[model samples]
Target: MKKIIIIIITLVLFGSCKKDEPAPIVVPIITSINPIQGNPDTEIAINGSGFSTVVSENIVKFNGVVAKVSSATSSTLIAKVPISSGSGLVEVSTSKGSANGPSFTYIPDIFVGGIESNGSKFVGKYWKNGVAVNVTNGTNNVTIYSIAVSGNDVYLAGYETVGSVKVAKYWKNGIENILSDQSKDAFCYSIAIDGTDVYVAGSEFNGNQYVAKYWKNGISVSLTNGQVSAEAHGIAISDGNVYVTGQEALPAGPLVAKYWKNGIATSLTDGKYDASAWSIVVSGNDIYISGYEDNGVNYARYWKNGLTNALSYNGNNIVDQIDQIVVSGSDVYVAGRQSKTALYWKNGIAVPLTNGSNLSFAHSIFLYGSDIFVAGNEFNGTAKVGKYWKNGSAVNLTNGFFDCSPWGIIVR
Candidate 1:
């Protein structure tokens, strides 16, 4: 009887211990889902609470597609969108119940044609069969002055003034990146891309004069501090050296056109009125810089090897700027505006894109293989329309509502 009573007591104690065990943890709740449907390569952001120690494995997928978690916060997760083509619906599962987001459309692959220049705006568009297609509009709010292309990525340089302050900005793959934090003023006039690094050249104001400044990988480099009040207008990368061109202050209170190889200043012109370098080209060991000289009149010009190339003089008046340069086999091509008309030169032969009455100006040039593309604006009596030319034939790309223009072009 005593042994039976002891065994029963032991069993009762074990059952009581089992009944007192701790309960399972309750999963945190997800509050909201935003941009539920996203295209491939797009980032999807998820918001919730109690995500303090969230891991990639914690991210569950009901659709079976692998989603890469890019970043995570205490209450949010940034994940790379999967190749969800058919139906854009995605269901996310976790230790808690599943949550679903709506379907989103995929962004189509764009074939880059090359960059083109309008006077103040640089426009990039896709071209097919010698015609412009899918031209980006609403570019007047921001000016695209110059462009550089590497692979399918395109970079732009320019400045936009919001009220009294000018801000230097650039765009990569069509996404805008502001380089300056100044509430005063800044401008990026030229852009160059070497491998994956992007560089820009321009000027930043320092009280009285504009200081020469450039950026490498979005980092600033001031070639001229505040001493001489220099300006950097063009930038190019050849071999391994970075070349920039513009004007420097002189003792006589005028600017002299100059270029720097890896920041080593080299004077290309010594004129007093206003000498500026707008574009640069490199061929083998030869470096060519183009702009205009304000002697008695504004003349389109360029220089090679510190010596003036005979082709520098294009016989234009009151207006001239070389916004871009490209080397074709053994020939060189330069594009800019000459006296309110779009102008291009190949091997020293000047070709006008429009009559002076059109008030058109080409700010950039692109040569893909044997084809050439130009971007700018077309004046139609009352307003200017954004336009791109493939093979010298003009095609309007935007309506005249906001004076849009193509500033950059690339062919991929």
Candidate 2:
């Protein structure tokens, strides 16, 4: 009788402890979530109290989108942001109850494209905020010079080596679309997109000389004759009008910087100085173009409505190689190399992206909301490090192992 009574008492004590385990973890009290804003699939830690230690016991939702809780503890839970999740409050559900946390903002995805070398031949690829996706085969030489995002599709313009010639092509969502045949060598420099229409600006060799042209939905339209060598470096579409910027070589051997508005060319610089327009932007009724003019040496200058103005830094006109030009709310932004250091100029004030620690160059500038993004690369004396800047904050995209050159960027 005594042995039976002792065993019964032990069983009652163990059952009581099992019921107490779930009672202590009441409704979760969320203290905070680190990094209030992040892109989709980004891993974020939720710091709080009353969370169950078992991962299956805690459920996290970002704006009603369920997130996978990889791990959990009494005070914290690591959850991944669900794909396609919008901005809203974060909620955590447990067996005890549900708790509402701080609002989680979603950062729109950033897209950038360039070339990365793997010891031997260079191949083309792009990055969505550091996650790389290969667009070209590694056996041949391929390069992506420009990239644009439209809705859910991504378009890239560049060239690929086939036999003895370089063929101009564009990739729509990583699928290749050839723009030029193998009759002559060709090169693609820029790409732009407007609802259902894909435009690519490039140069093609037509027996005698390179012709400035652009392709609309894979159909070619020549902007210049085959008389002189000319190449379209940048393209933009505004208010149903197509604007192409390039340099037309004169008979006297001087290159004249010009832009063609619906096939009608307007010269921005005389043929006396060797100049080329690298980028063009149209805002409202204002037209802006950025490039360099070589008088004695190369000097960065931008033309606003056919009037030339130098890029200013510290109240003085700065000199360097400018690559991309952008206009946001009456402010002009330019990205390039200043004294071998990568920098971007906002309304003529030079904002250096690097501390001159290593050789760097800023090639593309993009504006998102109130944030400024610049894409470029830096040479650290050992390897080329792919980098991009957001509002003057540096973000390394590569691990400095292979060479990376990012020439274009777009954030949406």
Candidate 3:
């Protein structure tokens, strides 16, 4: 009787111990992810169960590439979207198991500036998210060289041939505003806006020479004395100060790279070699200009507050030019062409966007978050087509059947 009672008690104890043991490990279950869509580097919150408390052990991926996990808990995680990610499912992996969340989409708005032919003449136009809006009425040959967007307003600067002269003009939301009188030939190459004031920079013929000039709210300010030929190719405004960049043609001398701050001329290079400033931008108090200088050969260069930085090419006699510039945070980006190949430089490091099989040009660059966008044209065997590249992947704005060129870009 004592043995039977002892055996029964032992069996009851063993049954209790078995009942107290934990169940099998449960795999993570991802219910959802906040902000189902965003650009690259966008931070997202993941809600799931059975995640690792240690963030490094918790693996998050957007389309198989590992994402950067900032923080992780047993049931929550914060991860930054990877730069190489596109529209795909977000997956979370832990030691327990892996689970997939909802799909994440990455889409960004893009604007491109260029010209389109209307049978007989080229008409100035710009595309917003792949839809084209006409800047001109196709009455005359119009060329749009630059574009700027502020809030809901759109501005395009270029020239329209009127009679025998090219009249400097800019369009504000499809309405034309003349910057120069029809008495002399003029052209506007760049446009900028500050608050309520509109600024247009270009060249005007004054019967004697082409004068580098900028118009602020329709008031003209000449950077040159009209005796020497000069042209303004880019304009920027910061803290009530106006900046314009171009080249001044001295009498019988090479073109000089120059910039004007509030109508005060500053020479970036002497008139010994041919140099031109095609783009200008101001970040904080630092000024940057992009162009090319002829050091026996045309070499791509940019000046940061008057200090020169040169870009490298493949070989001798290869021409390079920087056509546009933008400063975001502490990074400086310049877009241009090197020996007919499209490229952009980030802080003086060249990133080629195209192979040298055909002619390609990168005319404008814009950075939205961690995404880099370049707008320009690429020759598709038969004709040049307007297109933009998002992180080196090309998106055509125009069909390859027609010739088009993109000169400027902006992303908001």
- Top of the candidates by lDDT: 2
Estimate TM-scores for all models.
0.64, 0.76, 0.74
Query: Candidate 3, residues 1-412: lDDT per residue as tens digits?
Result: 9999999999999999999999989788888898888766678999979888899888899978789999988888999887546678989988888998898886655778889776678889999889999878888998899998875688988999988889999999999999898899999999998998999999999999999999989889999998888999899988888899999997996899999988888999988888899899898889999988887754788899999888765653345667888888888889988776899889878888999788999989998778899999889998788999999999998887767888988875
Candidate 2 residues 1-412, lDDT tens each? 9999999999999999998785444788888998899987688899999899999999899999899999999999999888667789999999889999999999879888998898787788899978998888788788888999875687889999887899999998889999998879999999999999999999999999999999999999999988999999999999999999999999888999999999999999988888999899999999999988887644788889998877744453446678999998789998988766899877767898888788898999998878899999999888889889999888888888888999899986
Question: If both were scored by TM-score, which would come out higher, candidate 1 or candidate 3?
Answer: 3
Per-residue accuracy of model 1 over 338-374 as CA lDDT, tens digit each = 6677877888787778877778877667775466777
Predicted structure with the largest TM-score when compared to the true one: 2
After superposition, candidate 2 runs with Cα above 4 Å error: 1-104, 312-318
- C-alpha positional error of residue 25 in candidate 1 after TM-score superposition, expressed in Å: 60
Q: What is the Cα-based lDDT of residue 189 in candidate 3?
A: 91
- lDDT-based ranking, best first? 2, 3, 1
lDDT of 3: 0.87
